[model samples]
Target: MAEEKDAAEALVTDLQKKITDAFDVFDHESNKTVDVREIGTIIRSLGCCPTEGELHEMLAEMEEEEPTGYIRFDKFLPTMTKVLLERRYRPISDDIILRAFEVLDENKKGYLTRDELVKYMTEEGEPFTQEEMEEMISAAVDPDKNIVPYKDYAAMMVIDD
Candidate 1:
């Protein structure tokens, strides 16, 4: 138990060190801080590819206490750690998702209409609950196309190793 705790602490320390190193590359002046705007780059340097909205949300959380113009190592480390760990949770791969979607696309159109997706999502297999269907549709559907472009949707969900 102690060993596990030690290992977790060690990993956190390692992450902190990496975060500091990445921040330093942009810090330039040895202030142990960087402009709040640089937070996205610093997090990406540590290999967390957060979406722009996600970055904005994180920045909002940081400013919850009060607006800040710069981020210190201490503040950045925890946020970066959380982002890294979250990124570690792998998304469903494109190939697997493509195969699954292919099964849904009997007409070979490379897409699924909203109605088809709704039917399959709500009535087929284990089925997605109403909320799940809504969320999936919001993420997977193309507003203009009014269809789930399965290939593009699958690609969007794939995360590089």
Candidate 2:
């Protein structure tokens, strides 16, 4: 009861500290504010993945608060807390990620060669852009085998909270 409340409050404090520290790095001039234009990077640095449209929407709220177009720490903190609590950007479950890879593996090979994944990611369904494919492959492929061992990759991809 009381302990749970204290734990939740402590978590919020930690999140606020992290966001403030990241915001300071980009603040460069120590203005205690950041350009609204860089809000996406700020959010990403804090491990939040809001889409472009979502960023636009969030920035709209900041626009109302700071007519000067820079976001202060006070304005940034509550907005970030709301976004985190909503959990809209939570990582996809590992089970679902593994299932997706299994579908691509086709022959139950338990892995995807680099070339095969490139083709599937770039040509199938809502395709990955060239940059997205390159990034995923670089991080996910086995250098020796030249393949993506997706079972292991899923563990890397799913960042729990």
Write one digit per residue (lDDT tens) for candidate 1, span 1-161: 99999998898888778877898998977987788888877776666655657777877766537666887776777877877656642346689999999998999999999999999977876666687689899998899989998888888866575
lDDT per residue (tens digit) for residues 1-161 in model 2: 99999999998888878878888887967978888767878887777766667778888876654378688777888888877766555557889999999998889999999999898887877666677788899999999999999999988987665
Structure candidate 2, residue pairs in collision: none
Best by lDDT: 2
| Model 1: lowest-lDDT 10 consecutive positions | 84-93
TM values, all candidates: 0.52, 0.72
RMSD of each: 9.0, 3.4
Question: Could you say which candidate leads in TM-score?
Answer: 2
RMSD of 2: 3.4
Q: Cα deviation of 111 in candidate 1 (Å)?
A: 18
